[model samples]
Target: MTHETRSSRRNFLAASSGLVAAAAMPPALAQTAPFLITSATDVLLPKGKAQRVVICGGGWGGLNAAKQLRQLAPQLEVVVLERNPVFFSCPMSNKWLVGQVDTNFLTFDYLKVSEKYGYRFIQTEILAVERDRKRVVTAAGSLDYDYLILSPGIRYNYEAWFGNDRRAAEATRARFPAAYVPNAEHFRLKQAIEDFKGGEIVMTLPPPPQRCPPSPYERACLLAWHLKTKKIKGHITILDHKDGIRPIGLGFRQAFEELYKDQITYVPNAQVKEVDPFNQRIKTAAGDFKFDHAILMAPHQAGDLAWKAGVIGKNAEGKPTGWSGVDPLFLNLRDDRDVYVIGDAVGIVSPQFLFYPKAGHVANRHAKIVARYIAERAAGREPAYSLPDNLCYMWVSADPQQAINVQFDYKIGDFQDKGKVILQTQIDDNERRPELIVEDFRWFGYMREDLFG
Candidate 1:
């Protein structure tokens, strides 16, 4: 991000500043299961007389969109359909895993946020979207919608690693759980980390454009830190699928060499060829390896809801891109004004947004920008377009409380670029600084307070 871009981003963040508050973690409102109402539905789902907007997914994107819509158009009934009753923060979860933060720090109640912001939230599985009939077919029932915003986030594409072997994929998911998906996965991974009476913990990274580009490396650093501090008889091996530490390479590389050289092994471009999860072994392009424990991050795709919604786009070769076909700038379906896909599930073919990193900060900004467009269109006004800017933070050490930061700013391209956005990145040497972590806390805390406080 340039100086000007950074200032603008700061202003936007400052605008959302509210009294920081974290809701008390609640027990499961009902039995935690699929296709079931986890929250109390005895009161009945809100049947608003006005135009209804259903925001799918209760994570960062959907929740922010709900908040904005209620404020922008109070007459519009905003309903968010999410599978989980409690909201979990994937952003700060690495901190949680290493005991720097508690589970309470990562969990928030959806009902409390819904009530506080005057939006309706239903904890029911979203089966599919009936776009032609203008309704959502869910476990609860068919829900008619005036407008639908899909923001269900990312899901692992296990097929990339496991091929057609369902059992292998499931076994890998069960044994070497990747914690990127939130809540349960995080719990499983955390337990695995704690239980490691270890020799070598193997960690793998998925290819680019996945949610939070820095997550795997960050976790590796934290895991190494944990082993170093706890005097655990182990080291970490990062089987990176990419060429190198991306976006903020120098920072991570410096840390790897200076701080964790004795405890971490960095391997680049280790394209996974085959997996033998049952035998606790994997074959990658570089070599074959067996592990005492493994954290396997499979390739990513749009969440199931996006596929079920029939919004996923196809490439020029007719292969499914595993992301929604939506207007690059406005985030609305080009063919259907009534449908929009936000967050990590959204994709574009243009040069600017193609392979845009599916991170939460961008999703939050993207949702709000789309909310304005939706509100303006609802008022029968022509909507304007704007690009998004974001910041990503990673913790390389818990002991010194130091971290690395990367900022991205974007602007509408010139005449030759055909209205697409151009990226401006600002990460000089990617130094690990203590202040960066503080800003990270504020970023997470402010977002929590803005919607739930």
Candidate 2:
């Protein structure tokens, strides 16, 4: 089939209501088989002639983008570069920490994901992004790409908390496991919690723009639940840098007040001034607090690759912003159309209208949008970009199996001249429900299948 005819056929199939409905079916049905890519266009590359796409980071965003790209345009050559061989999801990992789920359930094989989607998977650390040459340099070798999607994720900003003492910062991180990222830290935190005989367990929430806005609160709640169930004589203390646990502030506040009032103590605006890992204490603006166990959610910034690429630059006051600048419409770098930034790495455009929570659900939705845009561009068409949405669920307790849900919607303004972006947010009723917990698992299952099945 001619390229145009092939594109038309694929578009028709994608738009079919039946196919759309099938795509929305539960994960149990969809996971039974590989998602069929029904493009008649054969993978007829004439000696390295296909457009090459490189996806950096194999998290929810990059993996989903690769899968969607292959589903939309299988003829194109796609590659995924991930630092780690195994993909451990940050979403719902708190459950693993609280003993709700096993660690194996949070991990997946990158090789399987790549094989299932027919993409080259390379486990290598990215050294640099050669934007002018449209190539990425890894520890192993340099890779050229026609298009690059960066979902490099976030890196903890230790300097912000520890100042000039790099060694002290590293020591602090080692001593207190954040467990925000999917790593050995989760197990460390779990062990610490388990070993705690009594006294206080202090968990600090960093300032805004952290991944999974509601996660720290969720962790606090679940940990309190664990302690309560175990009859451990311990009080869980939450120190928040912000005014309160936000995005789902009201809901979380109510949860703390009603359920774990005796076991949980929440102190807001408790910014960290210094951390004494040796003494097992944190000096914050609110006050100096000592703990038998601690999990410090340190400040976070865009991945180091972004800073190395010069995409993350100083602001007007000559302070590092620690995020990549991308076009609000396409998530493409302002200076380089060939490069796109998504997920937590994307800099805030406008906090009022364009800001999105740094969450896995947001990243998954971003992957779809970027993948569709790239597919349309490859087909020589102006794509109809879809408005990205974010859906997040936070569990409140384990025994009762209750959770809270939040959704965010965005749209461009009606006036073409103004080009203002608009945002709308909704939180499910403050009352947590067992059904929401079931739906949370269903949501996670669908997301997993969408990216790796």
Against the true structure, candidate 1 reaches a TM-score of 0.88
Pairs that collide in candidate 2 are: none
Q: Write the per-residue lDDT of candidate 1 for residues 254-339, one digit (tens) a residue.
A: 99999899899999999888888888888998788899899998988999999998898988999998888888777888899889
Q: Give, for candidate 2, the lowest lDDT window spanning 10 residues.
A: 38-47
Candidate 2 per-residue lDDT, tens place, 1-453, comes to 665776566457546643555475333222212222333122211124678888988898999999999889876778788888788888988888878888788889887777667777777787888788777777755667899999988889888877888887777777788987668777777788778898888988888778888889998899888888888898988999997667777788888999899889999889998888888888998999999888888898898888866788467898887888888778888888878888888886554544578888889989999999999999999887676788888999999899887887776664445556654555555678899899999999999898777
Evaluated at residue 107, the lDDT of candidate 2 is 89
Clashes of 1: 2
C-alpha positional error of residue 147 in candidate 1 after TM-score superposition, expressed in Å: 0.8
* Best candidate (score: TM-score): 1
Scored against the true structure, residue 412 in model 1 reaches a CA lDDT of 58
